[model samples]
Target: MADAEMVRRETSFWRHAVVTVPAILLLGLASGWVSNSGYGNPWFDGLAKPQAMPPGWTFGAVWTTLYILLGVALAFILQAPNSGTRRTALILFGSQMMLNFLWSPVFFGMHQPRLALAIIVVMLVLSIATTFWVARIRKAAAWLMVPYMVWLSFASILNYEIIRLNPAS
Candidate 1:
């Protein structure tokens, strides 16, 4: 009987994980697509990008992977029961995600690298705070965000450099 109960609990846990993970990933995908729309080709090619700018393909690959990690982190957070801290963490996560979605459009579509850099700086700060809050709920979830933070750090540098190179942009 104990073994059966354990199995049931594990199954339920996995079911929740499945639902939450995909939902978060879908959010990321939708955001990315919305931000990238009407911003390809000449608009992107026209920019005076930094030498360290990754190729277009790299952006797709990296974001896909990062989104997966983010989804997993959010899933871990959702596994926990409701609380004030959880609410705050979720809010922070949503805010940073919104900021993340805004970046591509501002930098690529609108050709406003300086503004994008500022947005990214805000994103970095919010992400750090979110990660810290998530850590208080689930250490694993917080750890999962570390790679994302690292990526954002690199991205901020890239954004700054783009602004420097494309002052007219």
Candidate 2:
């Protein structure tokens, strides 16, 4: 009986890991793609940035950390037992993630901070909604998202400031 239970637990751990590692990696990949695609472009370089803007490298570091947190939070929610809200939470999470993926292209690739700000606003709202959904299922998962929420809020403000600072951009 003891040996059977050990095997069962081990299997469960691996099962969760199979889902989690990829989720985290995928989020990291998306973050990398956005940063790489947007950074150092002529259009982005030409824009007037706010004084509050951190050094260029800081964005990559901060975003990578945030994306990892997002993945952990998502993994928890995804691994939770199937529930109706799980689906909703996943959808909301996915929507915000897609929006998150689009922000860089809109802001730097297309040189449209104004539009990016708009996208971030919606993304922020969806993120808050996702947090709530995850909270209902797994408090740890929800807590994992707190940093992401804070960062998104900060990013939204930064986007707004960029639009204001560079009206020409």
Candidate 3:
């Protein structure tokens, strides 16, 4: 087996958990802040929602779960041996995260679902690219990102539907 794979396999659960858990916690906190800041205002409440739109509470639950998964995936990348692939993966990861954070502000705070849709589309692409890069370095890390990718796709459809539902916005 490769040295990196061996290192990963040999890692103690407690040691790894100590690192990944805190990192995940921080991610969850930041994402929660972003969500709280831009969600549940009168403006958003006034907007026409798509037929398939989930309940308001669902967003919070789903995002929290996804952020935790993202933290674990990032831990894998960070723990991996430094290499060009790792660097590239990190960049993609960072880019997608920023876009993810920005979407709420653009859509809910700014009240521009159209622009938000555009942002999410880009986010989806970046997320996919990140997944591919992460897969190259660590398949398990890549698997961690699957839910995120799926969520982004679902989010894109929701955004598109929002646009169609509210043409004036």
Candidate 4:
């Protein structure tokens, strides 16, 4: 009977994990689309990018994967039993998500690469802290945030380069 209960609990935990991926992906897509709609298409093509700038397709692919991971991490945190650590984790997670959502608008829609770079730096720091907090509850949750942190690091560099190359943009 005890073994059966353990199995049931594990199954419940996994069910939440399975649902998180799609929910996060959808949120990512919605935010991306909303920001994309406000920006002028010609602006992107006309910008003077640094030589190191990635192919246009890469941005979408990388963000999609990171967003999925973010979703899973969040789901794990949500599943944790109520505790002070869980509350802090939720706050950190939500803060980073808000920052992530704002990035597209600042960079593409407003055409402020410098500001975007600054925002990304903050986002990176917050994400790292959030990862640490989540690790306290679930190590896998913390590990899941690694791709996002790495991607933001690269993005910050790219944003700085763009600001340097396109001073007038």
Best by TM-score: 4
* Lowest-sum lDDT 10-residue window in model 3: 31-40
Q: Which residue pairs of candidate 1 clash? A: none
lDDT value, residue 31 of candidate 2 = 53
Candidate 4, residues 46-103: lDDT per residue as tens digits?
A: 8777787777778788888898888888778878888999999999989988888888
In terms of lDDT, the best-performing candidate is 4
Error of 1 at 49 (Å): 1.8
lDDT of all predictions: 0.81, 0.79, 0.81, 0.83
> What's the CA error at residue 123 for candidate 2, in Å?
0.5
Model 1: C-alpha RMSD to truth? Answer: 2.6
lDDT score for candidate 4 against the true structure: 0.83
Best first by lDDT, ranked: 4, 1, 3, 2
The model with the greater lDDT, 1 or 4, is: 4
Question: Which run of 10 residues does model 4 get worst, by summed lDDT?
Answer: 35-44
lDDT of 2 by residue, 76-128 (tens): 77666688999999999999988887887777767778888999999999999
Model 1 residue 100 distance off true place after TM-score fit, in angstroms: 1.1
lDDT of 3 by residue, 2-80 (tens): 9987666557433665686677667656754655543457777777777888887787788778877887788778777
> TM-score ranking from best to worst?
4, 1, 2, 3
lDDT preference between candidates 2 and 4, better one: 4
**Which is the winner by TM-score between candidate 1 and candidate 4?**
4
Displacement of residue 88 (Cα, Å) in model 3 is: 0.4
Stretch of 10 with least lDDT, candidate 1 = 32-41
Instruction: Provide the global lDDT of candidate 2 against the true structure.
Output: 0.79
